[model samples]
Target chain A: MMETTTSLSFTEDGFEAFAAGREEPQWLSDLRNAAWKKFSELPWPARNDEEWIRTDIRQFKLDRYSLALEPLTSEATATALMRDGVELGGGCTSFDGRKVDSFLKDKWAEKGVVFGSFGDVIRSHGDLIQPYLLRRAVNPNYDKFAALHTAFMTGGTILYIPRGIVVDEPFHALSTLSNGSADFGHTLVILEDGAEATMLSETASEDVDGGGLHCGAIELVLNPGAHLRYVNLQNWGSNVWHFAHQKAVVDRDASLQWTIAAMGAKVAKVNQHVGLIGEGANCQVNGVMFTEGKQHLSYHTLQHHEAPNCRSDFLYKAGLQDKSRTVWRGMIKVDPIAQRTDGYQRNDNLLLSAAARADSIPGLEIEADDVRCTHGSTSGRVDDELIFYAQCRGYTRKEAIQMIVTGFFQKVFDRISIESVREALGLAIARRVREYE
Target chain B: MIDTLVIRDLHVSVEGKPILRGVTLTMNRGETHAMMGPNGSGKSTLGLAIMGHPNYEVTEGSIELNGEDLVEMSPDQRARAGMFLAFQRPIAIPGVKLADFLRHATTNVRRPDRKEGEELIPMRDFRKELKGNMEQLQMDVEFARRYVNDGFSGGEMKRAEILQLAMLQPKFAILDETDSGLDADAVRLASESIAEIGREKMGLLIITHHDKLLVHNPPEFTHVMLGGRLVETGGIELANELHSEGYDRIRKAYPEADAQNQAMLEKEDAQPVG
Candidate 1:
């Protein structure tokens, strides 16, 4: 069996123990084991590494955390815990590795769509899940976190849309971290050709008393001509440490848009990679992150064009206030074979206070002479002219600043194709802005 | 008697350079005041200062409205007190819907009791009102949905300023060089709109260099400004005199004194004010 490596020894051992006990297929076990060895041998990112230069990861003790196994006290208690520190809407399922609370599985399953926990998918649709299991679009050697997530991922959601299926509503899946316990979840999405859907996933901590850790992985595959929109809102408790690896592959003539809204976490790191492997593929990556109270968010993104005539656009905006900090490094790569490719990358930051800080680095690597690629990054305070204009229209200085920040983020919301999800995010962002006031 | 807008010995500066040196003007309810001057004659600076723009500082003198002090108030506060300024070059604000902005400004300036008596204008009513105003300005209905003043043509931008003035209904308005960029037909239409707005008890302070605006809608008092001072005050004929003889003649007349005092004497050939 093939096994993956992870940073934490206990997490690797626990997952290895699960595989051995279940007597899973040798190929799957070997994959996990190989992943575990890679996780142990890979050195932790240092300050000099270009990707991790602006983010410090020394404070995280990976070995001390292991996958959660104990059952929650009750379904009601688990539901309450998952609902805290985050917002969830229609057709939501909250799970704690043992029992599923408020599951709308049957209703969704009847519509020819599979919306359930990772364990359920493994039990019911093993054949459909086997081919994509542990198949990551993001390179495992990209960072230590990517290697770690491959070894210990246990539970998540698997969304499979059959051909020509279009779901008018958004389906939400939330994974809750038990108190004082570590969590490793996985999200697998396969949109068949001509399928259109939107999936929203939120990761939050169950315990408000102190910090915990959550490390998860997400993989998405879009067949030819499929459309998928994914939104991830990470509002872990202030004491939590979060590391996630998410990737998506768009096939010929397919399109995908991903929006990442990060608000809460003491220290967080995310690696998002998208590959347009087919001709005429399109993808847009938009994100807005707000950090305060000594929190730090580090984002690494890649837009890879491997086929001809593909387009990719990326915009990430961050707001740092009250001594908080953020780091964004994004790259657009065009291969020589990918002639006539169009790619753009932009990262803009707003510093609300003197103590807040942000670092943005946008780069482009083009191997095709016929391609058009441009990248830019800027970090600064709010525009005084915009603020003054708002004030002249009867808003106070504070009100004017808040309105500008809200308006700054509204651009991302405009790109969301789902109305209900957009509204939900709009309300959440408004509340966050008010909290600063 | 108290008037809608009263400026007394107004001294203003921009970037430490004096622009308005003790200029005085007043406009009562239902009255129109015309200010004529060549380029850089401090005509626009007076309008900006009177609107309490933060960039322009009043180093000396005072501005009042209906017996209340205006120099100490903020721009929005002055706006709420029934003052408006139609900018010569209106700024474009992107991502802000024009209709939403109009409603916000109107509701902000509305009296508290009156605001309570009426519901916030329904979207439909507001749209109809906006359509009417756009029709009056010869603008398409699509202009209302675009970002405020974003990508508007020269004439369209001026028409938008007037549309806002009509919707807001300020008691005193300072139209600074509103006719500078408009064509002859547009100037005639804008003049007619201003005259219609003036019939609603709104006092007008029209600033321009051309005599065409005054010919279309004559002013009750015409003031000539040169070197940051209101050097001459007379009836409407002063604008025609300056148009016929040109400002060089005024400069030659005041060669010994200051340029402002000389321009004042040149316009003094017309019917004099008390």
Candidate 2:
């Protein structure tokens, strides 16, 4: 273990006592010990760091918040998360990093789909999920925040789809924070060879008056010939500071689709990466975000091609108003052995107010000779003629801009395969846009 | 109150450069008038100004639709008060479906007379009406699925504008240079559709330079404009005279101003709308 200098609230003693109280397994306890040392040794990302060059978080002080020990869920939170009327094979929910409840539909449970809290899943099906836990996809030491998350993870949710099983509906998970507190939750998903499944995870906070902190991680592992559809919807309150590290690994001939909607939070930072690790694997990543009222949101993503004949595509679109700002940095990386890899990435930002700003940085790092990689980014207000045309149709000025903004995001919306939740997410972003007026 | 639209002593400018000067016109229900002028003679300016385009400032005029002053209202409000302007060159807005745009427009404009709690037309009924109208305008139903005027040909954009005119069915319609880029056959087809939609109820101000469309659906009166002002008014013979004589007589008549109108028109026709 590495040595550390500064003393923080979540120290070695605090983690050891919490792990002992929770009766964590030996492997988890060891993982936390190592992660805590790493977290303590590593310093917070500074403005000079390349990954954080565009986003300045100097005002955020970690000592101002304390970790929440118990679930803080309510009936209203559950009802709101399921209001989109999406069909789900299973659902699990957590509040303030603590598991409140989880269940699988009878048919899916009979078909060997396991979805339960971390503690329960480790005790019941640890052997089945052990190999994919931290072995391949996402490592806790990827960054400082990632390491901190591993040290504090408690009652996160786990989902496993056995080989050859196909779930007809998506699985849902929601995490809610009740007040000013710190919550660190981890999510792991495993799909065996030839299996197919989709998961939709959401994080939301109701109270915006009190400041909060959320550091989270998600890991997805797909075996050969598997298909996984994953989506994350984040709508934290305006007073929340959210940081997340999410990554996925796809094996030979596997297909993956991941969509992220970052529609809330006053200050947020997320790093998402995916690796096409085997021949003929394919992956698509799409993201949409809306910000207003002095909110600052930053996103970093990577598409790693590790094997030959892999294809990866990414698109991110954002709409900003008021004094809100956003930063999107993405990279397409191809390994030396990965030849004939096809990669594409694009970002589009629409600014509704003069004070709003958006920065899009797209990078390509290719060590192979025969690869196809392309990237593009654009930032501008909507075409004036568009507003004029909509106005000619009897729409008010506010209504006209709203329609133009919606149309600006139609290309991203067209890519969503989940039909039931499309309109719901669109309405949520529309609400954010309306707040500008 | 909705039977007439009056424009009195209208003077307008774009970016503070005078475009329309001291123009007056009136349109009553059942009347079809054509404001014919050469390029840059402010024919389209009148059409845009009456519809309250923000870029074109109405410096010295009042536009009243059924006794309600339109200069005090926004473009959408003027549209809600029953006025429409078919663009000379319709803009391309990607990802905006024509059908969806029309439904929202129809709802907002049609809501003024609607009873409280009365919903807009159901989707099924709206689609049926839209398809029927598309067929009438010689447009394939697939045009509704495409983005609004995005990647459309010149004739297609013109027809889409006409389709909007048909769908919205405003009280006073201004077709600004609708026949500029169409072939003879397409012009005749568009004219037939216009006559069908503007028959005896909607007052139409068909702003055009060519007499070809006028031959298909001749207006009851034709007003000639030059140097940003009305120069003359007559029957179809006036259009025939201008087309055959090439506006030289009007230039000779106004001498200083009408001649400049002819020169500006030539320069504008050389370089199309940006």
Candidate 3:
């Protein structure tokens, strides 16, 4: 494979070159320029920051990775776990921030549904996507990573469902990263009133031990009475540095079920938020994480009830082995006007080794008198008696532990309606379980 | 050829404390033996030791299954070698369905050489056999869908154990107070189920304090265990005698073992319960 690095160094000159390469609308270019200015002005997150307290990034140097402007002529190798044995309404694959292959069924496309590469869709349907692009769900100036992603974001996926069109088949999007490369991919999904769809988006590296950088964002916009089931799997090699900003906004009577699973990355810091913007909006969030070696993953989540009569449920479960550590901080915030709001959040961690550690912090802030909000967190090791009982039933010691770990995550898996997602996650986790005495 | 499990002067301990000083027993396939003892007499300790419970350390003697020493093997290996123990207080495994657990277990026990991740028993055949056994035990079809032992009442737990005993079909099976905490009807159902499962097919070791469990499956040999040792061995009449009169006569006849049993009971009382 040839190693061709672009002269894009995340500087002013590089940003200008990147924007010039794409003949996008002047409005989009203006958004990128403004974001680039913010990216250059904002400082890197300090260790004392609340979200970065447990996530150390001193070892992460942006200079070690460079943006790849040209797509690799040779095919990059990566596994797509969520695409097994399912016909799709649309599918897109990107490598090193460039579109490699993408296809959308004509039936859905003819029905006023737009799905394709982000770069292509933004050009063709600029007027349709301008209002929701970094304008509503996600704030590009939230942090340094968010600003950088908006400024240099390249090949990703965009899905738009017109009013009252419900797509039965799921849309698939996969982003593959090569060793020592950087991926600034952005995913945007827009659902109009009464529109419904399911989107499965995942990230993978060419090698399990490869190194890369992924600073991305996901914005999900659900209009009135719209429903969306979004599944995101982050399986980027063990040596990647991942930082992401993901959020979803639900309008009146709309509902969202989002499942996020992360099993890779040397160090990952993610901020996930959900906003109930209109009355009677409901959202359910399920998070599953498995880490090993010296990996560290920290997730800060917020369930914000901005409107009255909204409901939100969040559950996150993580399994850690070796010297890996996971930090989960969740909050449920209900505004004063959000009367009759119902919010629930829980985090559970299962430690598989003596050295492994998990920090769970669950908080609730309710200003509404007629609302109910509850949160709970737990961290414990696998019980020896459970292993012994399974062993007595003819499972090997390692197999028993694996089964118990799988059982530990079964609660979240049960909440997932996708069968292939469950099986793929189960097998992936089982393969990583090592025999511990 | 007949299978045999012979325990010769076995000694076991828990957390550096000796529980079973010296216990010896022998049983061939198609035989039933009743072991009657009071609490802390090391009855359950013996059952756990035979199945290689990690906490039960064997300090002396040997447990042989068909001329093979089991002390060196893991619990799963002992299970694969045709041995089963129905725990008195079975632990709950949440999120693992009973049917799935048994399917993996049955596949491994039947194919002793099977490795982890190997194909389990076919769902069709396994479900059919499980349905038959569950019906014989008078269990509801929904019981198979529940998590293993999770939130089960005492009677339900005992019935689940019997269902496992019926499915595994081990060569030597130990029933560790399997009838305790059960009402009269539940005990009778459990006793009849055990008899139907093990009567001419497997060797049975029934550990209990009451006669309800021994009603349908009369023991061919009755042994009195005091202070971790068998003081006397008799026939079915002995089990009836103990049930009717209690252990007053045996305690008086065996004063030394009785004293040791009292001391162990006091020590047990001082410790916190799990």
Candidate 4:
């Protein structure tokens, strides 16, 4: 077994060299330049910043890793990586800045849905990809990672659902990194009005034998009355550092639901922002994170109500066992004119061991006094009575606690409208809980 | 006769105020005992203390089941030791199916060898057993799939407890005001369940204030409790006497019993025990 060291760095030479070698669009090259400037100008998040108070990132050194321009094509390595995604019940496509693995095109392209490398989308469907790619749905000014992802993103997925088209099953795009590798994968989803689809973006590592870095971004746009369900299941094995920015813009009467399940990664930072931009727009954001074995998971969620009569609800639950730690900070902001806005935010956590810890910071900033706004945060252990009740029946203490925790997380699972995604999340959560126990 | 439950000089309290003081009772296998008392006479407290509820503290006493100490065990341990209590007010636990809970309790109390062998009840056998018990108690079959006592009416909750008693089949059972808050039909069904348990060689201790339950299943030993103490012990005829005269006669026959009762009353009024 090889020892891995996960690290990230900022260097203009590496960015420019990769861009020049790929012969990317000149406009994208300019965007990367602006992002690099922003990444350098912005200061590190401080303890006074309300969202970053409970999370300590002083130990995260970004100067230890260089950009990985090469792809791992070994048959054994690709075979091992594809096996991890097989359990998720979908065909997988793997990308390295140069070429895509054939498994994706041979199995996924026949469905009339585009599942390919970002470069392929630019080369084949430049007309369809021009207007919708990086259209500011995910602003690069939110945080340093957002800026970093925009500056160096190289490989990703481009999914375009034709009008009134429906995909009966899910297709997976798995982005992984090898030893001393750096990855920047971008996933762009555009669902025309009346289009229905389910897309899953899973990021993981082939193995944790050496240090690697994964910085990715996902942008989703749903037109009027379009329905889209996006699930990001990120379990980048240990000895990997991950940072991601995901944003979605929903139009009139359109519904977009985002479910994020985070299990691995030595240190993971995520920012998810959803904008309900039209009347009658509905958005639900549900996330479940399990942190164990000294893992650190930091999640920041924003429910921005920009349109009147729009509805948004966010529920984030985390379970911490072993000596792991997690921080969940969420804000529901109702703009001044966003009247009749219905929004709710709740963060509940279960600390299974004394050494494990969770911090929940839920807040509300409502400029409209007449709207309904509420936020709640709670962190505690499993209910003793519930546990005792289960134990008295025949289950051992471990089995009883596991069942209760699984049920505790079932509320989030209940919100999943897709049966396959719901089942996959349930099995994954159960497996993580058992591993921690 | 092998004693199934022996409670001697039991002094139980909640939050430093005594509820059951110097009360002694014993029930052997194949017998049933009825405890009749007025409100706040520590009847329910005695039942809860014997079952090892965490809220009720036994200040001084000993409860033994088949020569094994009961006070030293937890509520579940006591339950696993062949002792069961049908709560006057059952707590509702959501997301836990009634059938699942019953199967757990039954398998937990079974002998180790029986549990290890193929005799262990399968899911189908468990469902059939649950269905039979529900039918015997006149309960809806769908109730078995619902959460444990969640959103159940008062009558339905009591009947559910009896359903548990029928399925778990503990050696010694305590019915704490099981007949309270029930309609006539539900009362009759509950009493029938109690009588059926008594007929199965399972010792029973019934606590009640009215004679409605006694009308259906007559008790062998009738004890009248006043002020946390047993003032008199008689045959089933005592129930008839109390039914006719109300508890005032017991208060008149023992004047010091009344003052002692008053003291107990003031003690209870000062700090009420649940």
Candidate 5:
């Protein structure tokens, strides 16, 4: 058994020691200190807060989890889901917020593609990454969780694509957390003008039912005419408490296809935002969430049209079984100058059990006169007739319910361009379905 | 060994309303039967009850297939017992492809003892078989890729149902209004396809209003339902008589049953349209 490292708990001494031990650049250390100070000043989100009203975290004791000062090995590590049968340009794997393995193809590296752990890359290429690190996309002071993540963020993946370089193969990253530990991973991806890349990232636990805490951030900064397909699957253990702040900013003539699947977590609150910062920028986001047991997952998404003639489409589908619940709040905000913007947002929830619940709230705030913006939300139980129809065709009640639940999410899955991701998610959900009847 | 489905004075109700009062019928493999009835006469209810629909409560009597009581089984178990029902108004499964749905059904029915999550039939063989069935039904192969009955035209839905009937090839099959809402050419095609795929291969209980479907697969037995009971039983000639002439004569001859059928029809009309 690994010994507990409580000395790295949230404190001024701990923060200083953590930064000094990393031997990072002085500028990065100063940035962490500033974030640490901000984290100390910020207050915990109250129950009455708008975002926290539906997701209760009062029972979450932060002191129960501490940072691991030394590498902790485990017997059972979760196999990577997205990497199965996938040809990749590079891959990175981390355990308990410690980088253990990383590899990149020399062909891409020769063409000026940088892919590896964030800690090593940030230290070696600080001058190249300094402009976009915690600056453009994700706001570190948005909440206490975001501030803490910025302050203590450890092992993560970083991908830097030089100007006019487009790599066809995808890069995979996996983060695994052990019991009673914490993961404060930060992902940063920077693409220059006319460059393109695909990033597949996932998080899991050594034990399927283990307990831990994960406070993370992801920032995607796309320069002019850049294209990106970013897929992230959050499969933390059921006992984990997860909080993340992820954002992307698309520049002139750039496009982004972001697909996210959330299947695990005891209590999760995630903020996903996309900013159309330049003219002719476009984005399409597909979200699939399936929860069982007593998991509570809350997601808040924002499609901000900051420039004219931009388009954004967001669709989120969720399936809830057992006593689990999901809350999805989406907004399509069009700026006054963003005329000719075409924005659409939709959320559909399928309730597999009577005790399960879902809260779907969709909104739009458009100041552009010529923009066409629409949003719709639907929440309902699986129709008994659909189940009966399948049952009459020789499917057992359990298999019938499983097929129907899978069909419910097929619309969002169709939007995913990666075959391995789609297969992995489909199998993962099938394994979790029980006899809802 | 055993190839028979016998219904002994079966009584079924929807909610608290009685639909099938006392239906008794016996069918064997390699035989075709026609069940003719007017609207609200409980023809569909008998098929539903036979399939063990949860809403259709079988208060009394039993449905036996091959010496086994099916009333004690779930719908899926009944399906595995080689009994099939083609609904009048099939439900839509939005994101489920018809090919995938039929593949699973065929696998489960073929291997009744197979556990869940077990391997399905080989895809190459399944694909070739599904293609052949689709072609025989005069359907485009693209139809298999579409969602099951979602956004399908009335005619397309019926053809899809026939495709499933062809694929499953159950020992006993109930087709409810398999010819309704179809054009003459489509009806003729469906009739020919059903005769080719099912005639003399399985026991068929075809419930339809028109005789177009019967032209190709003539029933050996014809039963007329009124007041939730089979008031008349005859041969193929009886079907031709009912097709050429309406049920007015039969209704006039059976006054008590006529009165009950009128009462049920009136009650059905009183309910609101969806």
Candidate 6:
């Protein structure tokens, strides 16, 4: 089956056999081939690159990583500890790039809400999925990793809320990877005019020793008058190297509330961009990351206001302990047509140990004269006064520091409207904080 | 016998400059002592040093709690050993819910004898006791929802401090200038709460620069501090003496303390930040 190579590297014949064995559609094969061509042409991120300045990913040796290449082979275990779908709502669990379990409430299904496996949706709603697959959001050629993900994309999930349909239920998806395996998954969400829903997606590496790869992409589109709340929780284990490219486009009068929690992975680099493309559109993007013990995490975010009267806000907060380090680069861009646009972006970092380090770079690019745009970044140590107060209450220094760090992230956590996701993410953050202790 | 906190000839410093020097004092269980002086007389330093603030170095002397040396104990260790300090300026921790903070604190301090690293008090008991204490302090039940001192008024911060004292129920509490920023009503409430906590159950070290807060709950010992020295020890009448005469006579008598004040004013008159 040519499932592997001598050096655990990817080769042309192996990839062709891998794709053809899966019987992927011809167009998908062509798309993947083109993506691979682009990936081969581009260069690895350089030290002088503006976005790559604070983060150096030279240690990521892609050739050494191996893909499972087989879908649920014998003895394959679904290692993901699945979270329950909210009562009456529905969720799907994916094991090593294949859908495992999926369910949706009857009422929402009755309302024409399409929640299905990525492949199933592509075949069933082919017309609706074709045009916006990777064209409207998450451009494949944006970077080296984006093209790599597109070239090797295996499995994914899609949520489509039909026009005028208001889905009160949440649709969740979890992608799990086994040790010595790689998963290239994609997520796509489309809300037509006046459609509203929440999409919560999470990824984790199954507990095992050998290193793995969790590379993926996300595409979200909100039609005029549509409102969507999207959340992405990334908590791959210490041996996993995670990379993702996520982008969203909000139309006129539409709103997108996007929250991301990055708390795991040995090293992770992600690019998240949101575009307020229509007048009166609004978007709020938030991120929380807790890293410890030599973990290196980086996030590059862009909030683009392309139309007049659009509003955008982005806040990224991180807490680093032990020898962990984090880099956050957030940019807000206002177009010339975006008159009276309101844009704000901030990145805050708290260092829990002297060995921990954080770099926050907030930038604003305003091409419009009448726009109100601002950006700020701050990195500071924990306040001793706060710790002393907590100590006087009998809490150990660790607990006091944990309380302060939790408070720092709680501001972002509470904005996550989904109770289960909020709680699960909070627990994940707490667990990460306790990892050092 | 309950517990006692004895501070003997204590010397303290911040950033290599001395703040409190050769200050000796003691208060056994069921006793209230007020240490009063003008601003920058190191009254707060004494409270902080007793609480073992890391930066407030105890350069000399010993602080013993029930015969155990507190000078070497971490603040949390001292707290677990039944010490409390109501900061004149309580720090605001945004997003840390009041209920959660109170619960952890109540559990830790209340169960000092619990094995190290043991689970905290049950959430049920913690919530019930917190409700009762908040009610007693006239704190809004919603105070449980808000962050600790985050966006709270000056008076609310003061009340929150007392709330900790009442719930943690420490055997020794030092109120560092507890009456500085309170309104008349809040000051009255704070004094009443302190009085209710009482000297018999706990030793109280009230550090203040004014006698207004002392009126409601008079101290058994009123010690005047000048230039970080314990200059006088008398009844509450000494408070009245200073309240009327102000620090003029005392400042005149303690020329060295007055010289320290002059240097501070001159420093301020120069470039403050520089």
Q: Against the unseen true structure, what C-alpha lDDT does each candidate score? A: 0.73, 0.82, 0.91, 0.74, 0.90, 0.81
Residue A264, model 6: Cα distance from true site in angstroms = 1.7
Every candidate's fraction of true contacts kept comes to 0.17, 0.70, 0.68, 0.13, 0.75, 0.87
| Candidate 4 chain A worst ten-residue window by lDDT | A1-10
- Model 5 RMSD in Å is 2.0
Q: Mind giving the per-residue lDDT tens digits that candidate 2 earns over A1-437?
A: 01132212576676766666666567777888889899999989977998888777888887775565533434425234433777778888777667788888999888888998777888888778777776678888988888888888765679999999999788888877766656687889999999999998888875644357888888999889999989888888888888989899999999999989987787889989999999999998879899888899999999999999999999999999998999999999999999999999999999998899999999999999999999999999866666777778787777778778888889988998887557867777766665233
Which structure among the candidates has the greatest TM-score?
A: 3
lDDT of 4 by residue, B1-274 (tens): 5657888899887887777878888888777788887777777788778877666788998999887998988666777777777877776665567777677667766642233223455789888888987887777899988877789999888888888888878788888889989988878878887787554478878888778888767888899887788889998899889988898889888776567667766666544332
Per-residue CA lDDT of model 5 for B103-211, tens digit only, reads 9999999999989989999999999999999888889999999999999999999999999999899999999989999999999999999899899999999998888
**Fraction of real interface contacts that model 5 preserves:** 0.75
> Residue A396 CA error for candidate 4 (Å)?
4.4
Q: Rank the candidates by TM-score, best first.
A: 3, 5, 2, 6, 1, 4
Task: Please provide, for model 1 over B1-274, each residue's C-alpha lDDT reduced to its tens digit, 9 standing for 90 to 100.
Answer: 5456778999887666566788888888778888887655677778778777676899999898888998998776777787888877776665667777677667666642233224455778778888887787777888888777779888877888888888888888888777878899999988888777664367888888887777766888888877677778888888788889887765565553256544534543321110
Kindly list the per-residue Cα lDDT of model 4 for residues A383-418, writing each as its tens digit.
655554443443445556666676668678878776
lDDT tens per residue, model 5, A1-437: 23545338777877878887888888888888888899999999988998999999999988777788875455338778888988999999888888988999999999989889988898768899988988999998898998899889898899999999999999999999887788889999999999999999999988889889999999999999999999999999999999999999999999999998999889999999999999999999999999999999999999999999999999999999989999999999999999999999999999999999999989889888999999999998988877788888999999988888888999999999889989999999999988965
For candidate 1, the docking band is incorrect
Candidate 1, residue A343: Cα displacement in angstroms equals 2.9
Q: Candidate 6: how close is chain B to the reference, as a TM-score?
A: 0.92
Q: Put down candidate 3 lDDT per residue, A248-305, tens digits, no spaces.
A: 9999999999999999999999999999999999999999999999999999999999
User: In model 5, which runs have C-alpha deviations exceeding 4 angstroms?
Assistant: A1-7, A73-76, B266-274
**Candidate 1 residue-wise lDDT, A1-437, digit = tens:** 01133222465456566665554455556666777778878888878988778778788886566554444454523322123333332344544433354354455467678767776766777778777776646455456666666665666788888888887566677766555456677888898898988878776666443467777778888989999988877766677788888889998999999888887778888888899999999999888788777889988898999999999989898877788899898989899999999999988887877788888878888899999898888787776555545444544455556656766666776777666656666555555553232
Model 2's DockQ?
Answer: 0.60
